[model samples]
Target: MTDALQAMKALIEEINHHNYLYYTLDQPGIADADYDKLYDKLVAMERETGIVLPDSPTGRVGDQLLKGFDEHKHRARLWSLDKAQNHEDLTAWHTRAAKLVNDYNTRNPENPLPPLSFVVELKFDGLTLNLTYEHGRLVQAATRGNGVVGEGILAQVKTIKSVPLTIPYTDGVIEVQGEGIMNLSVLEAYNQTAAEPLKNARNAAAGALRNLNPKVTAERKLNAYFYNIGYTDGLTFADHREMVEFLRENRFRISPFVRYFDSIEEVAQELDAVVSMRNTFDFLIDGLVVKVSDMRTREALGYTDKFPRWAVAFKFEAEEAITTLQSVSWEVGRTGKITPVAKVEPVDIAGVTVQNCTLNNIGDIERKNLKHALGSQVYIRRSNDVIPEILGKVTEEQDGEEIVFPEQCPSCGSPLELKGAHLFCLNRLECRPQLIGRITHFASRDAMDIETFSIMTAEQLYQELGVRDPADLYGLTFDDLIKLERFGEKKANNLLAAFEKSKQCDLASFLFALGIPNTGKTTTKVLADHYRSLDKLMEATAEELVLLQDIGDIVADSIVSFFRDPVMQRSIERLLQAGVNPVSEEAPVIMNAENPFFGKTIVLTGTLSSMSRDEAAKKLEALGAKITGSVSKKTDIVVAGESAGSKLTKAQQLGIRIIDDEQELLQLLNG
Candidate 1:
């Protein structure tokens, strides 16, 4: 190799090692800033030299967009694993595997039992990708499109920070197979800002990897953990566990949850443990992949055309059931959009009796062709093991009649209009349901957090006290509340007190509480923080509003339209007249506080020793400190406690200050 080529190889090796440490091991030998500096230096060097190595990280970006996916035949056929749905199914699979191995050994006679052992690993909820490496450099990465042929995703895969551009093992050639998964935290954060949230992590990862922009794929933070060597030269292992350990040592991202078991019962127990701990993990896992540990036994058991006889995926049972749609009702949300809700005859799914499910919007009703007629048989499926959704009409016409969309708002009798598939109540102020929903939303924990006012109280105040909107909430009196059904003097006083306290909520929360269309808690906060006051945000033009990150035309228009409403404008004036100061024009500064994070953005990592994460966050917020979700350049302090993982390492690498306990934080706050 020439000097430039050798240097390029060294750079690739260094970057790949860092990638393995950060993404795979969840430990980093260097900080993110330092890593970025190194990466930038290498890129600049390649640019200046004008001699790019074939395996250089810069070579990953495709020069041109392809019209469609082109399939390349797989070197080795990728087969779908047979699945065991429940414990019984798992036991049956184990018994079958044992029997197959025992029968094979008996036939051989001289081979003996072959030492039966199994390797159990988490079945990641992601797209399977096959990566081929030549001379320790990743040459090709392809999606497992149809088991036989897959679209070449090498260019896209190279953008993934987790996938190493060069393999650690400097061998002849190796083909490693793994699943490309979008981290659950990343997906959740993405969805919070996404126009339409993805259904699950797997779909998000798959969609992100296929995007035209490599930068977009890079932003998704897609990760991969190699589970099997599809084909490798000059290496052999007696057991699957040993092979996984070998891969780990070689700086390959190996499956972390792999466990070895000696008996069928032991395997079942381990699988159960894995399932129980699923929620605690940061990535999505759909099932457990169990394979015979002994390579000799696996060979003896052999494989079928579609699956391995030695291995099976023990999948978690689908949380789904059939129920009768007893009634369908239209609920006017705070934003005046009508949502269809299905009241069903109770049916047990995943140990819970689900009697009600969200129909999302009118689009869902029409898509599912859900009839309002009572007694409609509907099949409900929990999408991704949570949030019940009506799949489709199970049995068409039951004893119930077909339901029709209401021509008028159910709460205010105002005529409704169909904006796209949604029924909108034009009476933004007078609509009783809308008013109640707005108040409830404003009082929600994510909003102003009026702890004492219940949704029922809001509704009652709207109906009984003739209150039309949130501002009218201030017009309420202790006497008026006491006269309501089930209201005592003490309850009435508490409700009034909460309403009074809510007036002091910051500008951002107040903006969020207004229930403007497309304005969520985060967006409202950004708008409020950016503008610093309600009047400034109200004066923002559509073009200006759209300039904010996560804000678009629809949201900007909604905001402008909200301020333009005569009733809403009058309500704002009334709130001002009633001494309801919504905005904190100036943030109070803690001067010379002992706390190290007086004016900095501090994030709590892992489980805190002194208090719950929420408690720590609350305490920090009380001390004029800004709390953020992730470790970025803006983060000034990271209070790491027990089990501090990625965030702690990232913070340390960034050279952000750290504190160990709440007392230290308190001192900072006081100082």
Candidate 2:
């Protein structure tokens, strides 16, 4: 029994030490599997002996579910900071603070406060967390409820791996304030597999923390970074920097980006730099917090009823807005999938007028509790230059109508089939929108490269010429086109010439133009390269297709299903009969280890005057350079061209190599 107790103690200490190292220090000394083994052994010992230490790591598993949160009184109030949206507002804040400092100095010459230096930290977009510690152990955790009092959520807070259960400061009681955040990457991963995807990171973190079950909070994998010591007994710090060091020494996760500036001008420049690189951060930051560095200065310039005079939050431009969801309109794609687009009352978001918001699918609508959101106020967010998405309804009162799902296709009046969360129109051949979309996509620049073929042309061909399918396009003669209203002799000849040019397209382009269910250009390229012929690709089993690098079960199934369709087969046969021959254009690429770009991940941004981005990507791929769409730390090089945007900025911030000169890029490609 003695030996078991000793072993349990040793294991507990070792696991806690590793947890501190991994979470607080960001320096993991032990592998995850090894750490888990140690944790499991400790758990087994505790179960056998029926004895668990007060601070045992196993307590963080969150087995207990709470009925409700008990209110906790904070020793020191958590004051909100005044907000400054622009430089002018920030300048005004600085002027007021400077004036207050001057007045204080004039009143008390002998005990004048030191110079008002500033501490700038990123304003993390998350839920506010206040952790109370007494005698080196975490006693309570709470939200910033009415400043002085909050709902206790210690169990939920403990599930956060980075939050310390015990601190080194055992002298007396202390309250540390921080933000509980769900990392953007973690949120994205969770949403990909979640039954109902979370709208945003901030809400995800907040909802997890406020949940009745601690297990729910643990599942979120929350993280916290302490910034302020709101209450402390028998502890004194000269400045914010010293306080931050104290937090760091006590194994608290302090942000590495805390910067001290003497002048507001320097702080303004730093804010700009932060804004430019904000997208690169794993966590969301809505703005920055600027606070007086010196504790004495902070004390001298006290607080108002709601906010501190010494500190201010610099808010960025609004990316979200609340607007009435007027109605829902279902739109069909080339794949026959039905999408619900919410038409909202016109509202401006981030300087753009947004009326329509994406609801993703019917599952998203139900999951987000937005089924009855029509005519109700809904929260809409515009981010990353994509179409705005309706997050959820602002209130649950349901002062709106329930969105009725269409029984039949709006365009073709065919029975709509519900597949998973999406509604699909099985009537693929006759559906106007679906057929038009497929034909338009086939003639797109990345597909068949059919010049002079527009959506208007497709519509005219569909209605006037009775062109039902892509196969029918090949049968069109100059006479058929010249008879149409706006078609002249030169235009007719050009259309015929383009059709002739499109017939001899590469296998990859031809495959892409076919509009296979889930297969994209990249997948088609992979299929073409692997098979080297269309016949081999058609004969490939899903099992064999899944063996490829990027091909998964979903894509493999899609490929097999597309090729086996009788209609698709007939369409291909008709194209072949019309002299449409898709041949493999790729010569064998020999990978050279000596090549500079070999095994490197490269991103191409902006326009390359010498060639199209696609042409450049192919050339780079020939030399063993892997092309990617986005810039990240993993990107080895960025081929920046004229008028590069956010990707270029991100590459610069990450210190990735950039090739801006066209001549230099040409030299590398040619060589």
**True-vs-predicted CA distance for residue 200, candidate 2, Å:** 26
lDDT of 1 at 58: 44
Give the candidate number with the greatest lDDT.
Answer: 2
Candidate 2: lDDT over CA atoms? 0.78
For model 2, state the Cα shift of residue 481 in Å.
Answer: 1.4
What is the TM-score of each predicted model, taking all chains together?
0.46, 0.46
Candidate 2, residue 659: how far the Cα is off, in Å = 24
lDDT of each: 0.69, 0.78
Candidate 2: stretches off by over 4 Å: 1-318, 589-671
Give a tens-digit lDDT track for model 1, residues 1-671: 23343344344444544444333232333322233333444566665664443223343321111225555656656776766656786777778878887787677776565667778889887778898887678888887754666778888899777778876676455677898998889888988988887656765687767666778778788888889876553355768877887767766787777788888789888877877888888887777888888876776576754477888877764555778888878877655767676788876553234666556566667677675446778877542222355667775544467777899999889999876656778887677776777777667644676766667778787779987766778888888888899999988888788878877878877776676654555677778878887788778888999898777676678789989878778878887787778775455444446555567788777666656776777667767688865666668888887666667877889898888676766665556
Clash totals in order: 12, 0
Least well predicted 10-residue stretch by lDDT in candidate 1: 58-67
